[model samples]
Target: MKEIAKISGIAYLMIFISGFYANFAVLESLLDINNPSITTANFINNHSQFGNGLLGFVMMLFFDALLVWSLFGLTKSISKNITYLASFFRLLHALFFGIALFKLWNIYQLTFNASNSVTLQHRVMKLLLDFDTLWTVGLLFFGIHLIVLGYLALKSQYIPKALGLLLLLAAIGYIIDGMAKLFMPNYIDYKDVFEVIVIMPSVIGEFSFTVWLLIKGFKKQRGLQNAKFV
Candidate 1:
């Protein structure tokens, strides 16, 4: 449990860092929503922008893959059934995101193909928007994983109950936010409010869990309860 927790914590941190850089630093830097022409020119002139974003996504995927089994190892002993469910959801999230990476890569392809065309900017901008939507779609599965994992954490004596509760709240926020973005027509109007109400807690909860796992590791269960849970 200790080893698994440590591994998962490190992987979690890697995922956070790489994902943040990819979205905020690389992707946001290259893509200009207000002026797609600028985005296209930048990408054509400096392919390194795309390269760095791709690298970040690759690193995130690698760490996410590691985290899947490490998390299973940490929680499996608690309840094999619930652990499998949570792991399954998380793997699904990873799979969806892996598939979504193609959309991101395709942005480059579309950019190159449309370089000589008058509609290059429009096409590339549409693809970027599509990739963003795809990312949110993957987060839907991630939300489910968090909910199940939170339940397991609460039930298990090794993990903190407060962390479990926070996870649950975070999962709710993710689900609500993702669903609104994917389905609601006027989502943008309330997006900022949603960010404060939902996204903030989710970030806080996940970051707290990561820190706790790294610092404290997993505590051992004991006696009949431990044996039964295991």
Candidate 2:
């Protein structure tokens, strides 16, 4: 149990690091939602960094898979059936994210085929928007996974109740922000507000949970009495 917890913690850390590098460092500046021409120019000039962003996604996905296995192993002793459900949701989110990466790859490949700048700009912008929209959809599944995982943690002997509560709160943040982005046309007007909503709880809850997994780890379960309802 402890060993799996440690592995899960490390996987979580890598996901954060790689995701940050991909989304913020390599991709953020290149994106101009209102101006496809700017985005096309940026992509042409920074194709190497764009490829690096894809590489970061590769690393994040690899560690993300590791996290699914480790988290399942770490928590199954608490409730075998429930843990399976949680893992399945996470797997779905990962699948969606992988598909999103394909869209990004299409955008990156455009860098090599930019002989027609006008067409390339429009194409790249559409792909970028598609990638963002698809990722928002994936966040919904991720939120659901977090909710179940939080509930399991809440009922566990070894996991902290506060961590469970934080995860639950974070789940709400993600689901709300994701739904808003998909359904609300005025989402841009409140983008900052929504970002903060998701960021605050997610960073605190997920980061603290990761640190806890590394530092304290989990104790072996003595019985399933606590998880009989599962």
Candidate 3:
């Protein structure tokens, strides 16, 4: 159990590192939200960097899949049924994220052909929109997964209640941002505000949880025997 906790924590850390680099550093850099022509030009000119983004997502997905198992192992002793539910949501998030990556691939393929610049830019823009939509869909499931995981953490003797509460707040932030992106037309107007609301909680909460898992997750501990949690 201790080894599993350590592994899951390490995997979580890797997912954040790779995902941020890929999504923000590589992919977002290549995209011009205001102009599709410029975005297509970036893909055609910086194909290597675009490929690196794909590679980064692949790495994130690999670790994400590992966490799906290790997290279940870590939490199952607390409540087998709830742990299963949490793990299922995380798996669904991974599948949705994988489909989003597929959209990235289609955009990357557009770089090579370049038969019609106008048509090419349009297709790339559409694919970029598709990727964003799909990723937002994935985040909805991820938010639910975090909520359940937070509940399990609160019931674990090894986990801190403070950290568990932070996880719940972060989960709410994620769900709010995701729903806004999907349903609100004026989301762009409030994008920065929404981003900050989500970022503050998620970055602090998840990073704190990762540190705890590395430092104390291996210690021998027991789950709460409360009937409500079980």
TM-score of each candidate? 0.90, 0.94, 0.95
The regions of model 1 sitting more than 4 angstroms off are: 112-117, 219-230
Q: RMSD in angstroms, all models?
A: 2.3, 1.9, 1.9
TM-score of 2: 0.94
Worst 10 residues of 3 by lDDT: 220-229
lDDT of 3 by residue, 62-163 (tens): 999999999988888778999999999999999999999999999888787465389888888888899899999999999999999999888876678898
Residue-level error in angstroms, candidate 1, position 207: 1.0
Q: What ranking of all candidate models by lDDT puts the best one first?
A: 3, 2, 1
| lDDT by residue for model 2 (105-219), tens | 9987878646647877778877888888888888899999999999988988778899999999999999999999999999999999999999899999999899999887655
With a 3 Å backbone cut-off (N, CA, C), the pairs that clash in candidate 2 are none
Error of 1 at 151 (Å): 0.4
Looking at model 1, report the run of 10 residues with the lowest lDDT sum: 219-228
lDDT of 1: 0.82
- Candidate number with the higher TM-score (1 or 3): 3
Arranged by TM-score, best first: 3, 2, 1
Full-model lDDT for every candidate: 0.82, 0.87, 0.89
